[model samples]
Target: MRITNNMMTTASVRNINKNMERLSKAQEQVSTQSKIQQPSDDPVVASRAIRYRSYVARVEQYQKNVDNVTSWQEVTDSALSDLSDVMQQLKELVVQGSSDTLSDSDLAAIKEDVTQLQQTAIDTLNTSYGGRYVFGGYATDEEPYSMDADNNVLFKGQLISDFNDNGDEQAIKANIGYGTSVTVNVEGQDVTGMGSGNLFDTFAKVLDGLDSGDVSELSDTLDAIESNTDTILAAQADLGARMNYVSMVGKRLDNDYTTYKELMSNNEDVDMAEASAESATASTVYEASLSVGVKVMSKSLLDYLA
Candidate 1:
C-alpha cells in the first residue's frame, strides 16, 4: 500500500501521544517517590502495602499497651519498695520494745512509733497509679487497705488474711503482645499473707503487748512481722519478673515495627535514580516523535503561500 502524507501524520501523532504518556508516568514516579500513582497501576504492590501498613498499625497499638503496662508496674514496684522500708522501721521498733530493760513510758513511746509505721505501711499498700489503686485487684477505683473501728485490717471491706482464703483474688493483666499478657497488680493478700488477721492485726497484738507491759508476747509477735516481710518480698519478686518479661516483649515489638515499616516502604516506594533515568528516556522519545510528526505534515501554510 502506498503511504500518504495524511496517514503518516496521523500515525506520527498517535505515537507521540503514547510517548508523552510514558514520559508523564515516569516523571510522576520520580517526583512522588512512589512506584504507582494508584492501585490500578500495580494491584499486587498496592495490596502488599495495605497489608504491611495494617501490620505496622497493630504493632504500634501493642507497643502502646506495653508502655502503659510498664508504667503501671514501675509505680507498683516503687510503692512496694516504700512499704518494705516502712516494715523495716516497724521491725526496729518491735526489736527495741521487745527488750525488758525499757521503762513503761519507753515501751509506750515505741508502741506509738510502731502504730505510726503500720499506718504508713497501710497507706503504701493503698498506692495509686494514674488515679487507680495498684493493689486493689479489679477494685482499682477504691483503696485496698483500711483499718476498721477494731484495728482489724480490711482489704476491700474483707479481713486482710481472709481476703483470698477462698481463692477469689483476681489479677490485673495487661496485653503486651498477641495472645500474651502479664499480671501488673500485687494483691493486698499477697503483701500481708494469710497469717492471723494479717500484718496490721499482728501490729495490734504487738501494741497490746506493749500496753500491758508483756515482753514475752511482744517478743513472740516478731515472728509474724518477719513472715509479713517475707510475703511482701515475694510479691515484689513476682512483680519484678513480670516487668522483665514486658521489657522483652517491648523490644520484640520495636523490631516488628521497623520490619513492617520497611516492608511497606519496599512495596510502594520507587527507586528515584531508576525513575529519573526512565523519565529522561521517555522525554527523548516523545520529542523525537513530535519532530517526526511535524515533518509528516508536509502540506503546510508555506506550501499554500508558494
Candidate 2:
C-alpha cells in the first residue's frame, strides 16, 4: 500500500483535532460539574435527570403546601386554647353567680364578665391569619359569627371543615369521632343532647335570670353549661389530636424532603471526585494522541526515501 504525504498529514491533523475535541469536552464537564452536559453524552442519564428535576419540583410544591397548612393549623390550635381559657373563666363566674348569697350588683358584674367572655369567644371564632379565618374552613375570607339585634350570637359559617393534604382534596381526619365534614357551627336551633335547651338560648336565659335577680333558675342551665363546656373540650381534644397528627406528618415530610434531596443528588448532581479522575485520564489520553500525531506527521515520504 502506497501512502501519500498529504493523506498522512491530513490524518494526523484529524487525530489531533479529535483529541483536542475530547479534551475540550472533558474541560467543559469539569467546568459545568455535570457528567451529562448534552443529550448525546448519555441519553439515559439525561432522561433520568429530566425526571429527577420534575420530582424535585413536585417535592418543593408539596413542601409549600405543608407550610401553608401547618401555619394555619397553628393558628387554629391557639384559638382553641384561648377558647378553653375563656370557658374556664366563664365557668368560674357562673359558679360565683350561682351562689344564693350573691347580690344584684354582684350578678350584674358577673353578667358583664360573661358578656366579655362571650365576645372573646366570638373573636376567637373569627380569628384570622394572613387575612384568612383559621376556623372558618374553606370560607376563610368570611367571619364565622355575628351578633343579632337581641345581642345573641349566631354562627354564620358552614359546619363543613376542609383540610386538604398536598393540594389534593384528601379529607384528612381532623376529628376522631366527628366526621371530616362535621358541622361545627352549631346554630341556636340545632343544640341538643344536654336536655332541650341550646347553648345560645340557655345563655340568654341566664342573662334574663341575672337581670331579674333570680339566681335559682340557673341551676339546670349551669348543668347545661357544664355539658356545653364538655362538648367544647371534646371538640378541642379532637383539634389537638389533629394538630398532633399534622405535626407527625410534618416531621415525616421533613424526612421525605431530606431523602428526596439526597436521591436527587445521586441522580443529577455530579460527583466531583469521579469527574476529576475522568478529566485527568482524558488529559493523559489527549496528550498521548498529540505526541503520536506529531511523530507520525514529522515522518514524510522524502524522509523515508533518505
The best candidate by TM-score is: 1
TM-score for each of the candidates: 0.88, 0.78
The TM-score of predicted model 1 comes to: 0.88
The TM-score, computed over Cα atoms with residue i paired to residue i, of candidate 2 is 0.78
**lDDT of candidate 2?**
0.65
* Model 2 C-alpha lDDT per residue in residues 5-44, reported as the tens digit of each score: 7787788789778878878877887888777777888888
RMSD of each: 2.6, 6.3
- Among residues 3 or more apart in sequence or in different chains, the pairs in candidate 2 whose N, CA or C atoms overlap within 3 Å are none
lDDT of 2 at 241: 71
Per-residue C-alpha lDDT of model 1 across residues 172-216, encoded as one tens digit per residue: 887778899888788877887765747787888888998998888
Return the top candidate by lDDT. 1
The worst-scoring run of ten residues by lDDT in candidate 1 lies at: 160-169
